[model samples]
Target: MEFKKFKLFEQMKPTIRKEFIFLLFAALITGGCRKIFDLPKEKDYLSNNINFSNKIFEPILGRTNLMGGFNADNSTMPMKFEIVNARFGDGRPVTDLFQKAPTYVWTTAYNGLEKSLEEIEAKRKLEEHALFEIRSSGEFIMWASANNSLIKPRPADSTNFPQDTRYFDLKITNSGGQTVIKDLQVRPWRERPYEPSNDMNLYTGGPAPDPDFPNNPNTRDYIRPFMSNVIGDATDVNLGTNDDENDVIVYIRPFTGGNGHSLRFKVLNKDSVAINPAAFNETKWDKLVHGFNMQKTTEYVQYDVAYPIPLVEVPTAYAPGGSRAHAELKYSRIGFGGGRVVATFGIDFAIYKKGDWEIVFHFKKDNPKFQND
Candidate 1:
């Protein structure tokens, strides 16, 4: 009787243990399901559903011309000029301005000329003998202007004329199907007026002369002007020009290093631009030029004059998920002569320990008129 009782007790213990284990497992499963279901749909799956990533909308290659001309029909006039030469920040030719790379330079030439013949004639005379010229033999010319009337013309004989004429001796050579120039100039036009026609309230338009700030630890005070206006608040508010299918290639490089840096890219939209308290206000149209963040490095960095730095180090792990970095790009009718928009974007990178990372930022066209096939 004692043995039978012991055996029965042992049997009951095993059954109880099995039941406890099964109950625990069931509870875990139920809890897991509940937690999963309770999670916010947007938080758990929105990113996957949205498919937001830094995608290369357009990869520009080879020598391309960023041309600009007089457009009297829309009352637009050229305001700035630039001659960019491509080289790695380390002074190596990753591409050439005249041979490869996108046109990523900006300058000012005239303002208040996009209104009437009187304005154009007045500005033209001032421009022709303005003593400022951007002459380059190798670099392509990409002229941009603002439509503001407040911009005053530089003195006809001002010795301090803002001109970028370093293109006379510019040389571009191709090796391995890439441009390799030892020395090149990355200068923009200096003397020009500002127009305020297409300026947004969130941006202060002007040339971005400094590309090392905000990314280089050694240098600070990198203020990216909202627009390319060198005059009063009323400045040239027009976006740059780009023919359909012609992607704007922006080359991003570390202030010191040559290559192998990760870049972060982002695209802004009309709502993002308008609501950005760090950029625009409601009263005036702010021409918020793009911004970039990069890792501070001690290497010599350069850019390919041919491939304008499209948001640098695009499609990386550090990219802002969901939403492109160039969705806010829209052509400014106020100055777009051949149907182009003044768009803005930003970039960020990190240059720490070897094999570190860098980033880039800019706007991109959703339905760019390019051929994939």
Candidate 2:
């Protein structure tokens, strides 16, 4: 009986070993081997979570932060983020032309907001990739224009399709191949004009003389703001469509070798020329700003605003009679900003020959309505 039992135990050992081998093969096929080997598992750490400060608001004309306080997480993996598509809440597409990182119209506040090509280039060197870098950390920016970009959508014009309230979506992806989509909405930039009751004039090509001149003891200080009103017209045109030469005209009183107001202007068009006027009207002045006026052929008209010393009250120290300050219009286009090209209208003026010159009025693209100070 002992011999029989030993033989039976030997047979059972072979069967048990075979069963163990079969179980190991099943574990391998079912990914149990990954646990056995303790290999690092690919992690999906991306989540569909995001936050923005303002869900609905107007995008400032130039470059502005459309949304703030953005939050997201990509745990254990590097991720990439971008605006997958932009559109209006109305379903109209906001083209890629508006999405490319924009170059700023470097400005200093004076009459309005001065647009400086010289400063644009200078600031561009300092500003390269700064605004775009914000996207990596998670924020959405927009270049809003009722009428400035090659892109056809304008915030104004109620007859048009996309009137206001622009919308867009963001796409985020992680290294482990997970994706999430987020949505954003911004009020499109619109015209905000000041009312007449506020003692401001919309027709600022040339404003009325100060009402409180003598009554106000400090007339020089008081009148400066009112006289500092900008007088000009600007628009964002589509030049590529018709491909015609457009003119930007800035009316100026020439620098006729005196303590008189000296005018200097520049442009960013196909060609530019400065013509000194033989005379200018002191009393009834026209409000046409010296800059690009988009013709029917041109699709977009971009204008800049710069305030010069108020045309009122010339200094007592000038030559009695030089050129009776006639309207001389100067126009030029040296270069353009990369994104949402807005030509900041700027002019440097001097009381004397290139001395003590300063920017008078700066017309900001963002402040199109030309609000009163």
Candidate 3:
């Protein structure tokens, strides 16, 4: 029996060794492997309550805060009453006062309160209410005895009388539920107008009989104005359909000699479209440039040049009287252009003589067409 047991032990020994080697190889191959459980669920940071409140009431509350505030006097007494602890049918508080109250309520509640505080402060400082009574001819006067304690009585013929008074008709309700209907008036306190020594009418061009231009007569001659072509020979240039050509003209008119004489001109299209600054490209012959030189000669001659293509700038200059003429300008194009350019040109002449200056201008229409957009 002992011999048989030994022989069985010997047989099982190899089998056991084989199993140990297989287990060792398997452990080496899967040594770093790990089992993964589900990660903890992520938490949401934003709550629904905060989002709902912002969407509904934030904007309304912001406007209410701006529209209603303490009066200018910093008084705790609110000019307008806000109903607290109030709710709508849905149990939401009333945050908007502008929509709930009438239109006049806004001005009366806010503006009226401000004005009342200002008036009170002014009366306290200057010892007078700047209140003025209205007269039949739209004039105003500060009543002497009415504000006597706060203000001294003015003479019956005080020159500083109020000239223009703006009155606002309003009805106000206080927090205490007291209603007051009143007319608020603003007084205009402006300086006196300087009266001229001589009568000068702007409608008719003439000199005033003052010391500056004494005995100076109106030398301006109203002539039949003609559109003179100064640059290119385009007496009958046909601009293609939906296109335009520019021509410059110098208008010469006589006037009393003065300093700082100059002219300003503006062109308007046929459809009453003002020539926007872009049509004068350097490559286009349709655009024109103009200049005037009085120092070179008494003649107010205008030099006009037409560009074969549209240009960005035009070179030009002008002078004042015959002695020291000093004026300059550069014309440039702006905006897209299409067929047919109809323009109205305007000129304003400014001339100074004997310490006096005069201004005049001519209004004329010019229409020229081109072929493309």
92-111, model 2: which lDDT tens digit per residue?
A: 67563344443433343222
Q: Who wins the TM-score comparison?
A: 2
Q: For each candidate, C-alpha RMSD in Å?
A: 27.5, 20.9, 28.3
Q: Please estimate how well model 3 matches the true structure, expressed as its whole-model Cα lDDT.
A: 0.26
- Model 1: lowest-lDDT 10 consecutive positions: 55-64
**Per-candidate clash tally:** 100, 42, 37
- State the lDDT of candidate 3 residue by residue for 172-224, as single tens digits: 23333333223332222111111111233222223223334445664222312
**TM-score of every model versus the real structure:** 0.17, 0.34, 0.17
Q: Give me the runs in candidate 3 sitting further than 4 Å from their true place.
A: 1-203, 206-264, 270-272, 281-349, 353-365, 370-373
lDDT of 2 at 300: 16
Best by lDDT: 2
Could you tell me how far off, in angstroms, the CA of residue 74 lies in candidate 2 after the best superposition? 7.5
Model 2 bad stretches (over 4 Å): 1-38, 42-44, 63-66, 73-78, 96-123, 126-134, 143-164, 176-179, 190-373
- Candidate 2, number of clashes: 42
Greater lDDT among 1 and 2 belongs to: 2
